[model samples]
Target: MTGERTASGLALEVLQQLWLGGVRDVVLCPGSRSAPFALALDSADRSGDLRLHVRVDERSAGFLALGLSTGSRRPVAVVTTSGTAVGNLLPAVMEAHHTGRRIVVVSADRPERLRGTGANQTTVQAGIFGTFARCHDVTAGVAVDGLSSLVAQACSGAGPTQLNVQLDGDLTPPDPDPLTWWHRPDNRATAQLRQAGDVGVQPSVSVPTDGEPLPLGPRTVVVAGDDAGPAARMLAEAAGWPLVAEPTSGARIGRQALRTGRLLLTTALRDEVERVVVIGHPTLSRPVTGLISDSALEVLSVRGRSGVATDPGRVARVLDVVPRVEAPEDPTWFRRWQAADERLSQLIDSGLAAAQGDSPRASGAPDLSPLAVAAVVGAAVGAHTTLVVGSSNPVRDLDVMATPWPALEHRFVVGNRGLAGIDGMVSTAVGIALGRPRAARTIAYLGDLTFLHDTNGLMVGPSEPRPDLTLVVLNDDGGAIFSTLEQGGRRYADAFERVFATPHGTDLAALCAAHHTAYERVDDLGRLAEALAESPSGARVLEVRVSRADRRAEAAWLRQLAEQAVPGDDPSR
Candidate 1:
């Protein structure tokens, strides 16, 4: 924060600035080049000024930072060695860029002199993230004059920023007492670091205005996608429109929220949709997309993210701030949607109960039906639970089959709907669980592929901090989602299994066994509930074997049922 600085001193000043600038969490990916940052960050953590998380995987480290920052609503930094390690952070940084969260990438680099000279662990990291990060470079032994304020400046834009710190072998603190710099005064506080709630020049999430309001008279439904937050719920309630909130939107609560939102879209209600007010990223179901693609109806989208960008809709309008709408005096139309929602909810519930046999299981496990497994999981994640859903079949199954309750009453739904890719999901949820209160449970519902895909995240070092996470895996042995799509039709059945289904017969329990984590193979619905209620600590895995064969027919039957629930227009005035 002061005049001149040493190689190690620059690293210390950088860390101090990050702490002073309101970054409470920092993730370090261990490597030889970033030794100084690791030591300085450890000292900061020891002093209780900040919390440090160490991850060997740079990709996991990036996502962990993304989760920590999102959970805390504060800027988070990820430090790594140069070259590929820095490159590994691109995914999370790209996500943060679109979602608009502050994730600082601190990479150790060779001096500018050594750059482009075929150095080990050295690549063009200066602009590695490109437009995604507001980048800065700090050479070895450079004066500490502006070093402290760089992090704040990077995060000031409301997205991710990269800092390439060059260092030499004397990686330990230049000064013996890490506390010595504490008393050393500087102008850091006065410097323009991003202050809490400070709006910046970047594409900031638009706040609502008191200008001319968007009329809410036309039939409208708010589609809350991942990270949509409570804004969608507020709009739905304020305007008397049905809320089609996704699990992670945090808007799936109260009476306005339709648990059968997607199904309703597939019915006559879709034809009556005059306008669709889309909020967040509503990419979970095709019905929502089909409704939005209706050129006859007006579509509007609100933007945000979790693991992926959430702007997946064709809208007539896009709002930074949710517009206040005037509710209609007569609520006949909305009532129809609600009425259909209730009827369909009951019918689906009954259908699932009918599908599952009433007989007791001698093995004491739960039913293997995907619906039963997801339902038990829905019941298991009671209040104070953070439910992180994986993409693809698992999330879709839960959306269609799981019982609907008040938002966060059972759990706060979370997912990576930004890019919607199934990368680093297990790690991201792990980060969320670690950041939350210990009393709360963090459970993840994902398909076998999603679970196995991120199995590397479970490869944590023994000394690393572990969270209380119960991973419920629905193992169908293949991609069941394909069965519900055009690919499952007879025309493509010959190539469907090999091409779209992509079955991988690896036993999930065996994978959990190798990782030394608890594994539960559930085949009974009652036993599934019991397993979740026990609240096991650390990481655990539950595998529910399901059949992909019936998925197509079952989905068709559900659509037919929803349609029948909507009665033909009875003009009994």
Candidate 2:
């Protein structure tokens, strides 16, 4: 490949390295400057070497990549044109960076000589991502060796990376088999290959401690956010502390901890806990935020990545410990938390039982309440299966209504908790399924709007073995969760529905057909159970249609259940 030849071929060559390195999906935002990239990826797609996804909006594209990356564990790549197109990716990239998600952004740009000379769409592409990316490469000319090594580094690294390929206009696409630059016999490859082996362990010289454990206070609380995993349970057990966990944390509401509801928030803080040990990201509700602010206590934070400063200056102590794996114990503290956990479990049980007996009201023709759908989902799936909940109402409803499984089974729950967007729910679930083994089944519970938002995530190939996955789409037509908000009255209802809900008359069966996935329209509870019991292989879509009117009734019933379960005169209360 000569300098005069467009680096399109070299770019494709680098992309092939990424594909060979286990990248199954690539999101492309088309542009003239990025035509070469787009073309090469198109070729790869046709040959079945890589799966290409096209998104008009770069912001959505970036997030789609974020979701895919989070689900896949391995880095997923993104391609875009120069200037503002690259800038559009900032929000999702920042979120991915902070949350330690793996993603690679390959932006096409003009040559350096033309950068400052009033080029059409050019900016300081190099170093634009700052410390957010693990590595940034701005390459010009055709050098297979260098580009290949960089591609491997980007693919193998823990966080996101940028490869700004500056191209000359005369360059043309090369033959299909672009050179494998990464496979060259060089020191860089050797070192990177070695570094890949040490991916999970963060080098630590000393494990910091807050002197000695202070006497446990009555109001002391421990809150776990999304991605808290097993570490949250271990922490709560070790400290014997009551845990307030979000749905995405994989901690059951009545079993491992309490849900993040208004009442729980109030009670946890009513006694005025003097200290809080926040693990993972901060995902407390607004009321809890106020409580956290008003409490006269110190906050200690622990996370795998740095720069997540949600507690402001009150984060007296910070540690770089992996959220779910590390177990730091305090026997005395563990006893207090255990008692609190028991009290919360009893309250939740009573609440669920009361809700079950409430009169089932008449919902609309397509009567499918989001809460009801959630109940069906909770009951259908097995204890061992992973549940990847989408953002918006799906996660919130699950947090409140979902009960614990009978036995202790390793179940993982994931969401885009860092920025909490619905753009990549399907893709994230797909990636997560891909990460799991053949025996493991992953179920994705998402809303209708969220399902359509990133439907492209369903694309899978023969090489990318079909995951034992089930997709449960709660087709409520729009954002039903927002209806429960304070401004849900008649006056603002229409406007909210139009702008926020953005209802789409989507033919889910057709959508599944396009992706070659099995589609099952589940209207009754029995059908849902049968489908779950069989647990089919490959990607399957189960569309559970619920009427909007029924959703409202379900919400009302839930509130009543909460009220009756926790009598104002109860001693525990």
lDDT values for all models: 0.75, 0.65
lDDT of 2 by residue, 5-100 (tens): 447745666676676456767878878788777777776777666667777777767876776666556678899988899988876777787777
lDDT, candidate 1, at 293: 68
Q: Give the TM-score of candidate 1.
A: 0.89
What TM-score do all the candidates reach, one by one? 0.89, 0.76
Best by TM-score: 1
For model 1, residues 335-368, the per-residue Cα lDDT tens digits are 8888888898888888777767574444644346
Among all windows of ten consecutive residues in candidate 2, which has the lowest summed lDDT?
199-208
Judged by whole-model lDDT over C-alpha atoms, candidate 1 comes out at 0.75
